[model samples]
Target: MNLFRHAAFEISVASPDGLPFSPAPEVAFAGRSNAGKSSAINTLAGHTRLAYVSKTPGRTQLINLFRLKNGAALVDLPGYGYAEVPAAVRRQWQGLLEHYLTRRENLVGLVLIMDARRPFTDLDRKMVAWFGTTGKPIHCLLTKADKLTNQEQIKVLRDAKAEAASLVGNITLQLFSSLKKKGIEEVEKIVGGWLNPEIRGEAS
Candidate 1:
């Protein structure tokens, strides 16, 4: 089943205190602004506009949560590393991301989205290293794979996997394309396992 298909907007929290209590585990989707983070979520949920896709980066300043049919939640974190955003707003976003990733008890794992052509930027590396301290699993999705040639895709995937090996925590990498609807099942299976560990345990 497409686990994220049933995702519906729950709430948008601008501050840490505004975060709601969720009984189910949450999987956060985070990345640099313009990395196709919202597009990935919309594609995974099988919706055109579940997560707003804006032409302007840094538009998503709040943490948006979407509840799945199974009660699990998909957290859309504010995009980072936008030059146009004010320094104060960027600091606020950093604090919010740090707090949620490090302190959220119900967070199961993270789904880090990146452009396939450029897998990891300086900010992305910082995010990985910092979040790695949590010892939680991180599944890196190299989105916009369709933009690359087949050979380029293979090379990027290989290089990304190699690079992830040096990152802390349980890191997994995969190529994805929101435009082509590629890597949907692969992500569903991986993320579903995290949301519902019971099923994963049973399968194992």
Candidate 2:
């Protein structure tokens, strides 16, 4: 789709004031630290470094927003589950994330990135419930798919789907790998629909 041809970084929100208020539809990318969330963003945008908030893990402690050429917003939220970060700082991020998730008026959906090999943990399940309560469409991306064998991949995908189905409706799951640029188009297509629901459709 030549997504990069139309993609441009818009802004970075260190605090709530920096949050986008344009009322344009937005899809947020969220995951644990070292979970390949940043890599997935770069892949979807067709840019190798566009979403490189940091090469070192646990550094992107802000809500970074990128604007596509179509005027849709791609929000890169800071990674949770970083143990080295201070408890107070992590707590602050939790508060900030909760505020954004619960209060953002233009938020269209969430792209929950998870490590394919690891699958769901306690934190992921909780986050699923939290985002579900906000009534936002969520598409779970199982990142680093190349790390698993074909059979294992298929099993994990099925299990993840079943787990997610138990928690929320209107959810989509995709097998992804940023290294090989896998599932990039699928992610873009999903986000594209979020910004244009009339064209995307109302059903799975």
Candidate 3:
């Protein structure tokens, strides 16, 4: 079986204080609302519901952790930029996410999922800036690529790559489609590399 085929939900925490301290290296998935972050994880895990899928943009408001058989973990962070959610709730997530991203010691990489048609927005840029301070490797999956024509997908990939260098120091970009299962191998390899100490150097 592939390394991530058994990925299963371990826990969910609304605040940093509740975070479980694990010695295993962890890589997190984060993005704006409706960016296909959960779907990407489910696709990689070869499961239908590894991460909860919601039609509502802001329904996921917790930091969810998924554990692998190898003792490594994949974290799913709450999506940002959901204007309908209460301002107080959004502010709480801001603090919780910041603390986790900035201070978590086991974090080795961050997977930033983005919609191919709308790669980055004002909030997305803000997230890039915030994650930049961690100095960790970031891998961007331009999800929903199947929705675009080949030419359009290529153009978005080119543009996102061009902007990423200026935004994040250590970053990689690839096109993805959770529906069509596109780029699953690349995503798995990149994420797997991060969890494997022998090849983690290459991932970084």
Collision count for each candidate, in order: 0, 1, 0
Error of 3 at 175 (Å): 0.6
List ranges where model 1 is wrong by over 4 Å: 199-204
- Angstrom error at residue 11, model 2: 1.6
For all candidates in order, the CA lDDT equals 0.91, 0.81, 0.87
TM-score of 2: 0.91
- TM-score each candidate: 0.95, 0.91, 0.95
Residues 1-204, candidate 2: write the lDDT tens digits.
554344677778777668757866777888988889988888777777787747577889888888877777788899988888999998998888878877787788888989998767877776777788876689999999999999999999999998888885468899999888888778777776677757545632
Question: Which should have the higher lDDT, number 1 or number 3?
Answer: 1
Model 1 residue 175 CA deviation (Å) reads: 0.7
lDDT of 1 by residue, 1-204 (tens): 879997999899898678888667899999999999999999999999999999999999999999999888999999999998999989989999999999998888899999998888999998998789987789999999999999999999999998889878789989999999999999998887887768634643
Q: Which pairs clash (backbone N, Cα, C closer than 3 Å) in model 1?
A: none
User: Which is better, 1 or 3, measured by TM-score?
Assistant: 1
What is the lDDT, from 0 to 100, of the residue 34 in candidate 3? 95
**Model 3 C-alpha lDDT per residue in residues 99-155, reported as the tens digit of each score:** 888888889988998999898788888777888877887899999999999999989
